[model samples]
Target: MVIFIMRITWLLVASIFHAGPGGYLQYVVYIVTSLGFVRQSFDVIVDGIEQSIVEAHNNLRPGKIYVNNGDLLDAGVNRSPSAYLNNPAEERSKYQYNVDKQMTLVKFVDNEMGPVGSFNWFATHGTSMSRTNSLISGDNKGAAARFMEDWAEQNGVSKQKGHANSVDFRSLHLSSVLPRRVSTIIPEPNEITDDLMQLASSYVASGGRRLAASNITRRIRSTQENTAKFVSAFCQSNCGDVSPNVLGTFCIDTHLPCDFNHSTCNGKNELCYGRGPGYPDEFESTRIIASRQFLKAADLFNSASEEIQGKIDYRHTYLDFSQLGVSVSTSTGGQQVVKTCPAAMGFAFAAGTTDGPGAFDFKQGDDKGNPFWRLVRNLLKTPGKEQVECHAPKPILLDTGEMKEPYDWAPSILPIQIIRIGQLVILCVPGEFTTMAGRRLRDAVKNVLISGSNGEFNSNIHVVLAGLTNTYSQYVTTFEEYQIQRYEGASTLYGPHTLSAYIQEFKKLATAMVANQEVPTNIQPPDMLHKQIGLLPGVMFDTTPIGTNFGDVSSDVPANSNFRKGSTVNATFYSACPRNDLLTDGTFALVEKLNGKDWVPAYDDDDWSLQFKWSRPSKLSSKSFATLEWTIPEDAASGVYRLRHFGASKPIIGSVKHFTGASSAFAVR
Candidate 1:
């Protein structure tokens, strides 16, 4: 029953939070993926663990320290060597990491327990999904966080001390963008007005928040209503019987895994079993059924555990992986000094996953015996000659780490972080860690804490690896996986011992914390701030069509109009250059509700269901337009609503200026 609820909750998240412009098509793919089904259950288990921690430490002391000071997100200079032309050094200084932007204070909530909260603050780096997608988007992780923020705001929790930043609450929004093959795309539907769509989105966002808030019990109850609503609305025709053929063992003849039996896999790989698209596939169905039986059989441990008093502390530092060496445990009963190579990827990195197969004649999960791969490897791998030998078995395709003249191709300077609250410890990894690598790292951290010289830490220390955080360093796979030469293995930039090296460094950190000693400072990576560059030019200028003024409402819902359930609302405006002002911390548009005598914000650009699209009427015209839209769900309460657009215009030689567009009042009944 718990597993069933978990899968349904994932369906809600995939369809709402992570939905790109893909909409129904994307929904179908995710709902069917077996990976989503299984991994989502794990997410619930993690949540249960978290809830246990909260329940255990009900009366624990609130933390006095708030640690949101790492690289949260900043629009800084692109310091890649390729960004510079004539004078790389001079142009680079234009974009160095400023002290002000380095560690920003986004929001501070002073409470009786110091500052005890963690907002769904967006992670400041890219993931493998981001590297492949062309459209600008927040990965599933960020999208989930965005949903939490939006939901909190709607429920009057935005700035309320007891909401997102509660004195005794902390939530970890894990990314479940699954199937490992396809990317979730947010779609822009032209059906409804922005305000109506915002209302519809409130339904979904509220569902996401509930899902985030659930443990084992709450999930079971919430899933029935929320999941049914999502399927009814998004599934359209198939409603209750949507086909799960887009992924898993059912998706035969596709590039993704189809044989859950593992009979066809070369090495009988466990990863090949029941892995692919769709929820409740054969493997998942069986697991869910078994879980239900277990829940029925064991009622003794059903209640929440004793409250735990968790401590909240975090430490962050910079590490240069270029030449860092560590003593790794060896099978021969000794430790070996293994140094990480400069960042680089192999030929197989381009051979995308089975869910979304890549171009060319390449296929992943295969050895490098292919003639073409060998030829490409010999040609591209040998030219650099700088340090190709270090990242062996990877068949170095791009020696980005060693290439320095133009700009640093890959990051040598990366952020390493450890977040602790009570017995829960999160190793905030800056790179993607393969499944095995993550497990090993988690165990290593736990062991280090346990083996502290004086055993000063808590007896029950739990560790989880949170990857692709703070900064994007790329992939980290184990030596065994790296030798396999699959996409993840090839993308393991720092070489075979990357995982081992990370474990070693984390152990050192654990030891320091245990002994209550100051952390040792490592060599700083090269400063790209003075050497980075930006290729994309800034916005030139903005102008409306000859007669229209900027922010003019070109089209909108009728004045004093009424809309019904399952309808859409839309508004068009004479939009300006979006680049003129990125609106980093603000909204491009808003859905406002008429409350008493004043208007209240209901939704903004961050809402996935409310879309703001920018386009030009013609190729030769400098004028641009934006069509803001929303799809009203059946449950939207009858009320008066309006859409507002915020835009920016840059004159040829003048500073950027802001403008506004408002729609006529409308009613949803």
Candidate 2:
């Protein structure tokens, strides 16, 4: 009988889910046969392992007290002359983001732990995704940390926290080595038991206060009803606990009520049936705060998941360096041969649509009791797992954010599987733009991918842009949507013109990737004529800001250059520049670095905007950090190569040169 009841209950629950959002619940019946703990699904297990790795790191060497003062993100080594990261002067953060696709905080290891140099980049596990918790994969509990530690030792880095100020939280971000100490910046975790106790006290106090008033009103009503029964003149059934006077608001009926419990409520309803007007409504205030916080974190976690998935690793760190076009084969096959590596990637992950329960099956049949979290019961073997190379976006913090103060991020969406021989990148972007709108989108994504690939792979870059997905998921779609039209703000993910624009730019990426070679550019332009001077081509960059108001991120080039709060409103790009196809001479600009002291462009007003332009250059070398070049006209005399400036809500008037007068200066031959 128990078994039968359980089966019936399961069927009922399945039916309910099917009726819910996205029509995906019905599939649950087939997806999940048993409601017990499921350990299969690689997607579900990756998160837990990541967390465990973080925990192990904290256990071994806490983060703090590093020997160097340089930025950890830019740290480099002088181990090899061929690798850029091997440069002696580079900082840690720069090395992480630019070369290793990470953001590391150094935590030198101390000698107190086990074998000194037995690991690199060890992960830890923790229950939360908070600052101090171990880096866990979604749903996977401790597996991630264990794997990370093992992987580190395998990589031949010092596993023990050598006598160094260890435990820098960002040290986990290192691709090569785990920090040697625990993180010093982690906040004390909120105690759950204490918080619950406080909540209970508040709930009881409010409950008591409301109940007292309700009792008094009920007592008086009951007495009046009793009095009406005593004074009944006509033959009638018993008042049935209600006095005539109580029933008739105008009548004044009175009586002594012996039982005190049922005297003051509304005399009819539950709180009112035997109570009075002032009864507590049983509203849970603590629940309100707790629920909100939980939801916010969940949203953040989901967003993080998306970011993790989007990470596109291009640097062939441990793989055959030659595969990235670093070297070609000399076999008689006469093929454009590249070298290969001997590593197989272990578990990888991606983000699913977070649209209601359709987002994912977090629990079996949506049962809260069975929170089918990503807990790794086992860590399978892939002794030599390859690193999934990714292209990452720099993270920007919005002041009015859900996270606590000093929140940080870098846009590496998901960890993808390392495929064989070739790779593909697909984007479900937006469509439609004013004038040659699609043009910019195409060039922008293309340039980033190309540049990123070049930096990572070294030779032929492989990338493809799949625009015009038309899933109705938008990208700041405008014209109709941008004009405050319904759902335009969120629906248009990028904007209408993104589809066509990316389509064009991706054409180059696809060509490069498939051809297994960099698509060289040979286009040269004539100098501006003394009379009929060709307008020097300019490109605009969209550094998607903290908010969607378009206030922080929106600006047309040549107008608003003072992304900083205050300098001087000089040369300004028109906020609404009419698109001109003729001037769209294939120039591009992308913000590779926007967080340095030089890039910081704010004064009193925190909100700011800035742009960089990309043009062809006459020279080429390995040290050039930026890909932008300029157009030189024959008669067009040399001038200060500059960007315009604007202030806090100020208008632009003139250009702002990097140097006093040293910009794009040259004498024609």
Candidate 3:
């Protein structure tokens, strides 16, 4: 349940918050009062309710805020080195790797208890673990969170007054623009030797370590100590056009750079793949990138001194963006009214991004779509003349607004929310906004907050854009970017005037918030919970090799083995589908050390050093096995240890039953 909850939170609404030690009490109150059900989806409900609760808390302490900025992330996808070499100078300049490196830290201290909690914001995609990764890990950001939480627990911060030892409330702010900067392409089958291929296959089948984020977390943990229940949140920002694949894109076949404008190789997108800083070694690249972010953030956290002072306030409203008239300033400083059109994806949207190239012959910067695809798109939902005109220069591919058979394909009604924490304003946008677009929106809102506030706000105001909040509505790009029609621009669901509409609506929200006036909500979004579909099949029944029982050990630790730090202990057991029971509150594997008389748990699957993997011999058979691997940490205690596996099995006609297995005792010295 927790795994699903985290996945939903990360995917649906990337916003997270940590209440002080007493945060659980607030959630209890929220759930009991029925305020938790404010949204239709579980992820949205959590995000919305968290906003309310955090705002409520903000109204109280309204503590001092500090900020620091550093160019730590190489997130701009358009700034790929190969793109720079292939594109014209002017075009290259437009997509320079400009990232939001600002880290805003908010610290709340009780007069008597000293510091109680802290919150922070930064921008980077949580894609250190590539698509090839099969484990259900939180990638880098999650690793950083766990590291900080673990550090707090180990250092006795949880023992402070008013701190709940077991409670660590975290909120994930999904602020990435595109995908992580990591490559999403898999190695070619021909490139793998028989032995190496088998190892690679087994490594995945037997779960692998999430290196990058873990490295960052460990670095920070080893160096920092806190006096309070510190919550370090690596929140995302305007990364709509940003990617983690910093090395750049190249053709796999010829080893040459891909086409700059379209990101294709030999007229094909499939072979055009992006590379990370570590190039062939993705894990090394992840570590390199993670190190950069961790170093910068740590420096900022330690040196941030400017104190932000003001009132805590927020405003939220739902608006129908489709057909909304927006006033824009022309080159002559004259205002022109333009209306936004219905949601429609452009041809380039299917071309994907450099981090993960699209299939077929589709490519980026394609204003004119292929005729065959156009016909295919028409079969799905044809765009009307108005939509075609609204999204000029962008050839429509999927008319999402017109496809409503299985509920709305894309959201037309989006929630616009602005949260003001003292002088820092958080623009909780429901979609990914490109760098320039995000900047324009931030500047527009900041100007409104200052100019329209009538002395209510001043130059000290700071605004941050939080993307992918509350809901997912695809992307938003500048009008110029829309004209270019790259992936980000093409994915801009609304018409070309989309950014303008967002700027206008957000300014209204800022102005209303400044005046303490209520902006009436527009049409509410429909409840599509009933139309939700579960495509994945559930576990049927569990079986093992003919003679082996569910808990029977297939492979055990070697006898008389003397292991040391960094040594790995391996064990395998006949098992059942883990989905039968997620072990939400427990673990599938453990390392138990023998004491004088009793066995003490030294580690569990939750620890980074322990890995649990399940695999079936064949898809046709339900028989399966689980492998447990425990890599001893440098600080491991010298003692006798053994591996343990916990599982649940379901019979064809009987209830699910739990089982346990153990490995031969070994010495770690």
By lDDT, the best candidate is: 3
lDDT of 1 by residue, 1-669 (tens): 001011111111111112232211111122232221233233444565456455434534432222222332221111111111212345236644311122211122334422222222121122213122333444333333343332222222222333232321121112221110001111223354557544433321110011111111211112233221110000000001011112233232343643322112333232232221224343232222222212211111112122224454555567878777978778898988878888877765655443233446553444443566666655533435546678877666667676544555667776676766556566766666654466567677887888773554555554545555544565676676566666666777788788777887787777776666666557565544444333333467878766767767788676556788557788888887776655544667676666555655555665544668788777656788888786554434456667777777878787777777667767766
> Best candidate, TM-score-wise?
3
Off by over 4 Å in 2: 1-497, 520-669
Q: Tell me model 2's lDDT, rounded to 2 decimals.
A: 0.20
Measure candidate 3: CA RMSD.
Answer: 11.3
lDDT of 3: 0.63
Q: Candidate 1 — worst ten consecutive residues by lDDT sum?
A: 231-240
After TM-score superposition, the amount by which residue 55's alpha carbon in candidate 1 deviates from its true location, in angstroms, is 29
Regions of candidate 3 where Cα sits further than 4 Å from its true position: 1-97, 108-117, 152-230, 306-308, 567-569, 594-597
**79 in model 1: Cα distance from truth in Å?**
32
Candidate numbers sorted by lDDT from highest down:
3, 1, 2
TM-score, candidate number 1: 0.60
Question: Each candidate: what lDDT?
Answer: 0.47, 0.20, 0.63
lDDT by residue for model 2 over 1-669, one digit each (tens)?
A: 000011111100000011111211111211232231122222233453455455444545432222111121211111111122222333323333322211111122333432221111101111112111221122111222222222223223233432212232223233322211011112222332333223222211000011111221111112233211110000100000111111111101232221122121223111111111111110121112112222222122212211111222221101111122222223575535222221111110001011010112211011011112222201222111122121001011111111111211111111111111122233223221211122233344446555655454322322222222211111222222222211111122222222232333344444444345544333322221121211223323221112321111122223211122122222212121111111111111211111211221111110011222221222231111111222221112111123222111111343311100001111111
Selected candidate, larger lDDT, 1 vs 2: 1
Q: lDDT (0-100) at residue 406 of candidate 3? A: 47
